[model samples]
Target: MRLAIVLYPGFADWECALLMAAARTHLGVEIDVATADGATVTSMGGLDVSPHLSIDALDPAGFDGLVICGGTVWDTAEAPDLSGTIRTFDRDKRLVAAICGGVNALATCGLLDRVEHTGNNAASLAALHGYRGQTHYREQPQALRSGHVITAAGTAPISFAGEILRGLGLGSEELDGFLALYGREHVAATSAG
Candidate 1:
């Protein structure tokens, strides 16, 4: 699968990393990390990641899926009209996944209407109210799969990645392999408690 991960100036590094690791270790998929521009992108935590393509340079038809990374940037700065790009991909029936505040970006693009979604904060949840879709909030990291739109609550990277894998026609067993490769045993144990 050819996956495109949206990167902004202040995205979360761990979010991108986990998804990339899952794509690489589990699905054995070719992943491309892209930014609004071809420039290097930084995370909210000050980590920098280089991009494989810029939004302007990417051909939406070439990607199998697009994963938008969310953080403080989604709330403050204006993101590229990713909704249009996502809509184009959706028209072709490609998979689109958003995490945390990235859902806000998708909402702005009119993609969340009539789709079930969850976000990181109360503000994001409130934003979803104006959307045409069923909005839900839960404590557990749950992946709500509604057709082509795949969403997850905040900090649910494992579940989020699992959802993406499943959407790509992979299995939960692949997600487990990714977790093991990433040395997420401690996190799994802690969360399981």
Candidate 2:
């Protein structure tokens, strides 16, 4: 299946690295990167990446799902209005995944209002101010999924990836195997320490 990943300047690198790698290796999913302008965008860690398409140019129907990577910009005035694209994915019944500050896009678009979700924190998400979906927020430890939306805190990329794989219909055994290969210890350690 083909998936579209949205990246902005300062997008989080860790959020999708393992997911992208494991999904490619184990699930053979095809991925394309998109940005507001189809220009080269840099991650928060200073890695440069060129987007495969611009948001306006990407056809929602061409992708099986959409994944949004978080960055500080999601919380800023510079954030792009992704509501239309996100809504299209929702209408099409495709998976919509967001983590950390990327959750802001979902929140801003009114998608989080109906589905249970978690983010960097309640406050960061609450700070979205005009969003009327606060009551739908759940105070989970990390990842949360409701309907077609998958959300996680910035620090929970592994769990985030797990939730996304689960949404992709990967069997529990396959998820367990994939996690054992790359997640078990890290998840345990992160939880413990």
Candidate 3:
């Protein structure tokens, strides 16, 4: 399977780390990173990533799915408009996943209008000038999936990864095992203080 992952300035590197790792390690999926412009971008955590292509250069038909990483850039009026790209992916029934501020891209495109989706919060999304998908928002504390669209809150990267793995058609047994290991490590680290 081929997946297109979008990146931008100040993206949350942690959000898609597990998903990309598991996808490559277990599913053997091919991932191509992209950005609005075909250039290197920096993450919120200060990691630099060079995208394989620009969003304008990507064709939804060439990939099996798309993943939009969250960033502070999503809230800006100057952020690149990816609505057309998202619409193309959705029209083909390809998996579309977003987290945190990334959902703002989907919201801006009206992709969440009729789908059950969760993000930073309903209010954060409602704050967008032209967001008309408020009624379809879910107040879940974790990830929620509706049809081909999957969304999650900023703090739920593990849950986000689990759902994306599910979208990848990874077997439940494999998914559960990976999540169990991830959860244990995460809990251990957070509780070590």
Which candidate ranks first by TM-score, i.e. highest? 3
Error of 1 at 162 (Å): 0.5
Give the per-residue lDDT of model 2 (tens digit) for 78-142: 88889999999999999999988889989988898888888888887777855667788888766
Candidate 2, residue 92: Cα displacement in angstroms equals 1.0
Report model 2's TM-score to 2 decimal places.
0.91
**Taking the tens digit of each residue's C-alpha lDDT, what string does model 1 give over 1-193?**
7998888887876665777885887568999888886889889888878889987665667988888887777666464567667778778888998887787766777777666666665455555434544344433456667777887766777768877878888876646676566556455444455
- Global lDDT scores for all candidate models: 0.74, 0.85, 0.87
Which candidate ranks first by lDDT, i.e. highest? 3
Pitting candidate 1 against candidate 3, the one with the higher lDDT is: 3
**Residue 87 displacement in candidate 3 (angstroms):** 0.3
TM-score of each: 0.82, 0.91, 0.92
After superposition, the stretches of candidate 1 with alpha carbons farther than 4 Å from their true spots are 121-123, 128-130, 134-140, 172-193
Indicate the TM-score of model 3.
Answer: 0.92
lDDT of 1 at 128: 46
Residue-level lDDT tens digits of model 3 in 53-89: 9989878779988999998888787777889999999
